[model samples]
Target: MQYELAPMEGITGYIYRNAYVKYFGGMDRYYTPFIASTGLNHKELNDVLPEHNAAFMLGEEENAGSGETPPPRLVPQILTNRAEDFLAIADRLRQMGYSHVNLNLGCPSGTVASRGRGAGFLGVPRQLDAFLEEIYKKCPLSVSVKTRIGVADMEDWEELLGIYGKYPVEEVIIHPRIQRDFYKQPIRWEGVELALQQWERTGSGIPICYNGEIHSLAEYQALRQRFPQIRRVMLGRGVLKNPFLVKQLGQWENRLQATGDAGDENVREPETNEDNRGKQSSEYCGIGGYRESEAGTAREQRRKVLWAFHQELLDGYRKIMSGDQNALFKMKELWAYFGESFPGKEKALKKIRKAVSMAQYEAAVREVFYSKS
Candidate 1:
């Protein structure tokens, strides 16, 4: 089974990916946040440049001295509604050494959807169909698509799937949400089931991958029970609460399959209230941290790893980012998910959110990690 880290803008940049890889490496593929292709997008382009992603690059011997590497597991993702735009972006990345890219038809932001990009394209299936046809006809790099089921409902999903089947799409990663639902709806497993049935019914031979609210081992087990044929799993924001989730899932995959068990005893089912996002982020990397049942060494390791990862992220961002504000903006985005894990740091978290400068942000961070409970 292959495990992937889903690309989330602002949350999974090269610094974040590199730090996560350094401490807890389990993801088979780490997708970069989507790069916009239609207009001047220097920021996104710079984010995926070879120098920023050196750790995920190939070894010196394997890469033949070019900054480019072989077909990368560290995949770059592109967002555009125009076929010409996609081709242009693909060629640029190909020149930079990447051989693969993922099309972003899954972003649910209002601004993106309003522009007829991302999931809004799903509302216009004919145009999307034509766009796919043109891109596949001329795109230089291998193309995969990350998409939602439909715009507002599943009424047109069968037709949409048929359009996808008509193309030579390398893979389809389904998030099972419509534009209206965004990430609020508990994942509709039936959506993926429909894709599986359609793929089989048409003998499309296209691979299907599942992505959604997989917060705990029980949720993952239920997904596997429902779709055992699926071999690829991509984790998204839930990893923030438990950075070691991929590692844990990898270790327990075989045991769960052999025993036909529902979940790991050490892991608890996360609350299903998507509105309360902080509740999804946990204290111990989801490994029963600080629990009495766990060994002293295990607790010590958790502390050491989490602290080191935090320091690395803070230090790395400061080094690469121009002004303190940019790094502060990025770190604050992370703490929105991470602050929940530091149980006794509510006031400190507030300070972090309202922080105006690096000094204020770092002071709040120190309080959250070091202040007395």
Candidate 2:
């Protein structure tokens, strides 16, 4: 199964992607936050800079290095309603060495949707069709789309999927929620099933990737069981909540492969018993039973990895931003998701969130890690 790191507006920037790869790498693709179409400004250019997007190479040796995995593939995502602007941006990205670009039609922010951008474009099927037609004709690089089911009504997905089928896009990422639902409501799996059915019936040959509330390996396994043909999936908040999620899922697949259980279907059925759902893999189990020592060591390693990632983010932000406030702002946004990994640390996270200076922020980070460890 292919796993993608979903683009998050204020969170999944180049710095975060690099840090995540350097620490706990498993995601197959990492998407940059949406670069809105305002021509090509300095800020936008900085986001897709080839130097910043390249995989992080480890070790000092010229040819030989530790057996660490390479960084995930990076895909630049752009947000634009106008075909002309999209083609321009695509040309720029292609010139910068990106072979593929993703069009953002899934963002549900009111300001964006109000401007007839993002998910709002879903409200106008004819305009969307025209936009795709022009871009597909003129774009130099491969294009993919990320979209919600519709603007307001779930019924609108039928027409929307048909419009998507009309284009030769790389892939269509379905989030299974309408613009009005945002992230609050339970994901409309019915809508997702409908999309799969429609895509299959149309024989579009364009792959469909599901994205929504998948937080654990068991959830992913269940999703695979429900839709065995799905070969790709995108994770946003869940990955941020648990940095080890992708790694764990990948390891699970590897174990299955070793046992010859991973066949053409690509996933084995998970144990259905609720008690076994949360159990650790047998590879980590001790002779007597659960390996507390091994589990403890792994947890400690993860803590150190998270600390290293935090320091990298802090250092990277300091190098780019001009002041403590700017660095503090970015760090706080990160802690919003990073803090989820550490439960019962409300006070520590609150300190990090309320920090007004770099010194305070550094101290709070140390406190959070130290307390957790």
Candidate 3:
């Protein structure tokens, strides 16, 4: 099983990816948040600079001052309803060493949807088909799309899926919800499962990756049982709640390979000396090493991951923003997702959100993660 981290705009940037890689080390691919298209020539849209940092930030950099080969596996993502803009962005990303691009046709925000982009494009199949045709004609990299089922209703997906079947996209990532429902509703799995079968029958051969609401190992296992043939899965919110999930999957695979349990494998929690599990066992099942105890190893692991996450936010803030205003804006966005994991987290995050300066933000962060209380 392969895992890709979902691109949550403003939340999943270079620093976030870097921290994820350093601490989790299991994601097969990481995607950048969508870069909005701008400029008349679209050349600026094509210029990969700090804007391109998302694609190159993974892996190790030596000689602090030198530029060398990039280490992380990254795919550039773009959000544009216009084929010309998509092509421009793709061409530029390829020159910067990215061979894959994902179209953001699933974002549900009103401001984005109002422009006939993101989930809004799902409502118009002909326009999407036309735009894709133009993109295929000019793009230099493999193209994939991340999308929801429909703009406002599940009924709209049939025609939308038909349009997708005609294209040679590398992969189709389905979040399994209609646009109007936002991320709060249950995933429309029946629709997604049916589409997967249809896509395979047509011999599209392009892989299908499931996304959305994958909150725990049980959910992942159920999906695995339902679609045993699927080779790729994506995690968005689940990863934020428990960063160890992907690594656990990776460790399971490693254990399988080592034991030669190639088929009908039992995924029992592997027994190990308390010390070798690293971040996975320590943070996942909460302290007692997966044993049935509240203050066990799993809790310890969760605390460790959370601490690392907070420090990275500080590091990323310092690198990207010079003033408290910009840094605080970015930190608040992250707290929205990560705050759910810690005790008294909502109040801790609220304090950070209202902070007016770097000093205030630091005080709040220290209170939440570093205070003895």
Candidate 4:
């Protein structure tokens, strides 16, 4: 199973991606938040600046970086219905040394969809078909599409997938939710079943990737059991809630792929050290090498690594974004998801949310990392 980080508008920017790569690295691919057809703002441009994203790709200028694991590929995504605009963006990215781009037709924001872009484009199959026809003909690099199943129902998804199959789409990243579903629960897996059926019927050979709310290994394993053929999965909000999710999932996937095992057995907890076996472990499992209560040294190491990642974010944001407030704004958006991991830290999280200055944010975050659970 290849794990990817789904492009989220405000989250998953270069700073956050790099922070993730440096600490909890395992993602196979990272998509830059969809580049709006309106064009790149200074901040947005910074996101795709080959310089900022160099670490995610291998064979860079120095080819060495702070990332914990082998760096993953970075693919820039463009959200647009205009074929000309897509060609323009693709040209810019190609000039920037990128060889692959993802077309976004899954963004469900009202402002975006109102403009007949993103998921809104799915409502007009004819126009979407023409748009893909032109771009695929003119684009110089490989093209994949990240798209919703339909506008308000799954009825249109089959036709849309047919249109996609007609093109040389590198891959189809299906969210399985119609535009109206927005971000609701219980994704329409029937839509995915439909895609599989189409592949079986026509043998299009184009790869299919699933994107949804997979928050844990169990959710992912269940997905695999239901559709054992699936090998690629994209994760979004789950990564924010638990940064270690992909690392854990990737380890399982790599093991399965390497061993040729069915990987269907129950996943066991990491074995305790010979000296520490049979000890009562805390409920919390940490990304830090040491986890909860195995030992004092272990807990302190966990805190150190967590703080290191946070400091990198703070430092990276202050450099790229304009002021403390801008950095604070971006960080707070992430905290909405990141804060969920610490179940009882609501008050500490509130302090981080209400933080007005960088200093205040730092103090509150330190409390979050340092406070005893």
In terms of TM-score, the best-performing candidate is 4
Q: Write the per-residue lDDT of candidate 1 for residues 1-373, one digit (tens) a residue.
A: 7888999888898889889888887776789899885553776777778887776642223655778634336788988898898998888887777778899999999999989999988999999999999999998778889999988898888889999999889889999998889889867767898999999888998888889988666667778878999988889876876686676676568666678664566544432223233532333332322232456577558767877898899999999889989999989989887664555446777999999999998888877665643
Task: List model 4 lDDT by residue over 1-373, tens digit each.
Answer: 7778999988899899999889877788899998975466776688889888868662232334755555588889998889998999888888888888999999988998989999999999999999999998999888999999988787888899899999999889999888888998578989999999998899999998899978767678778889988878999988887776776677677778779774633333222232234444345534232235366675566567667877898898889788889989988998887775555555677999989988899889987777754
Model with the higher TM-score, candidate 2 or 4: 4
What does candidate 2's lDDT look like per residue over 184-285, in tens digits?
A: 888888898898888778787998888998866778777878988888999998777777778767866787768856442322222222223344533322
The sequence of per-residue lDDT tens digits that candidate 3 reaches over residues 1-373 is: 8788999766776677777777766776788778776331332343234454554542223335666534546776788998887887676666656677899999999999988999988888889999988887678777889989998788878777888887788899988888898889887888778788788777778788889887655577678778878889989977765566676666566765687553323333322232223434223333112332344455556567767767876687777677768777887777665554443334555787788887888888766654432
- State each model's CA lDDT, in order: 0.78, 0.77, 0.70, 0.80
List candidate 3 segments past 4 Å from native. Answer: 40-71, 252-305, 344-357, 370-373
User: Candidate 3: deviation at residue 31, Å?
Assistant: 0.9
Better of 1 and 2 by lDDT: 1
Q: Model 1 scores what on Cα lDDT?
A: 0.78
lDDT of model 4 at position 158: 86
| TM-score for each predicted model, relative to the true structure | 0.87, 0.86, 0.79, 0.87
TM-score of model 3 vs. true structure: 0.79
lDDT of 3 at 181: 81
**Residue pairs in clash, model 1:** none
Q: In candidate 1, how many clashes are counted?
A: 0
lDDT of 1 at 67: 82
Which candidate comes out best when scored by lDDT? 4
Question: How does model 4 score by TM-score?
Answer: 0.87
